[model samples]
Target: MFRISSVCLCLFASLAIADESSKPGRLTVAQKNGWATYDTELKKKEDAVNKACGSAVKSSYDRSTYPAFDPMKDRTQSACQMAVGTLVEVCRTPDGKAAVKEAVTKTVCRLSTEGTKVSLDGSVLTIHIDPEKSSIVGKEPGSYSWKSALEEVL
Candidate 1:
């Protein structure tokens, strides 16, 4: 009888959690505008980095060879690292730095509504979103804004 009661309680608790998560997440007008701006800036930066890296890789390959140069072997990983380096370089500039700070601040403010914790140790930046008490982790090196913000918050 006790075992059956415990099982029912566990089931009810799980259902309640699921119901909460199923509800849509809402953002204010300011947050929506901020997110749009961030999205556009992010896309522009990504395109620049990708174009630079792609050109470098293509030029490095010998297209004249009989066997078409296959750059896919571990190229993606290397390209990604190069892109990160490029992003870091961009972040070092005054304008880039300011953009990053503004983006981070806006993002943190939006996420704060759902409870967010941000931390940066060396190159790794960890963000914990407490909507459902789940954590998302990402690592990037030499992001000054990340370091500064983390220091200020934590």
Candidate 2:
């Protein structure tokens, strides 16, 4: 009975995988080439966010306190995440991946006025995209990257 149950569970798991893969308009990370770096960086940024805000607690406070408790106190971590998260989410698509690569290449050329090799590194290049103007990602129109805003704190 145990062996039969194990086989049935495996069959169900396989079906679930197949069902997800067959869905339309979904881009699995495995389908994209050269996305490992982005995934790694995303994980790192997520870790940073967790480290920064994970310990935050809600406590009953007096209304007369000079400074009120901040619900989202770690704005810098939040912003950096918004930027990194948007880039990764958009790059899940084939077209988005190509567009981000092209845009980053152009942004590197534009920003390297001092002839520094700042953008030559893939991970470095990935961090500095104009979230507001990027047409590939379908984030909110008013959404902006908080990376620069929270750089010192991060």
Candidate 3:
């Protein structure tokens, strides 16, 4: 009876340790800084893409009548394609590429606690919040609001 009790206690202790180890911990100072840097870089990229897309739309319409034209109506599939193309180009640089990769990895790490999965295809980023639901960013043209999505997730 004494040996059986000891074995059971050991198993219980191991299980507790395993569970604790699986839990996500707080980010370190360096990790926080890295995330901030990534956020800044992403913001810059978004601004650039938005500017380009805005210009494209503005140029497509007559200047005098532009005010009457609804911009939302212009945000079609082609506009999204252009935005994605611009995003792909912007991240083609070595520094931009590294920043984007690090951001995505960090986001995945942070969301792992909720069993979230993130995937990127071109500029369209998808965050699988759960098995039944997901949130997407950069999928819509003129809507490069990734920061908002990150805020919602965090």
Per-candidate Cα lDDT values, in order, are 0.38, 0.35, 0.38
Residue pairs that clash (backbone atoms under 3 angstroms), model 1: none
TM-score leader: 3
The worst-scoring run of ten residues by lDDT in candidate 2 lies at 57-66
CA shift of 20, model 1, Å: 9.1
| C-alpha lDDT of residue 126 in model 2 | 24
Better model by TM-score: candidate 1 vs candidate 3: 3
* Per-residue lDDT of model 2, residues 1-154, tens digit only: 9999999999999999999766554334542322343334445654443334332111111212212222333122233335544444444556554544444321111111122111224323322333233322222343333332222212
TM-score attained by model 1: 0.26
Q: What is the C-alpha RMSD of each candidate to the true structure, in Å?
A: 17.6, 20.8, 18.2
TM-score for all models, in order of appearance:
0.26, 0.25, 0.37
Model 1 lDDT tens row, 1-154: 9999999999999999999876654555754554455445444544553343231111121112212212232122232223233434445556654443433221111122243345544433333333333232223333333234343432
Candidate no. 2 TM-score: 0.25
List pairs with backbone clashes in candidate 3.
none
Q: Which pairs of residues collide in candidate 2?
A: none
Model 1: worst 10 consecutive residues (lDDT sum)? 57-66
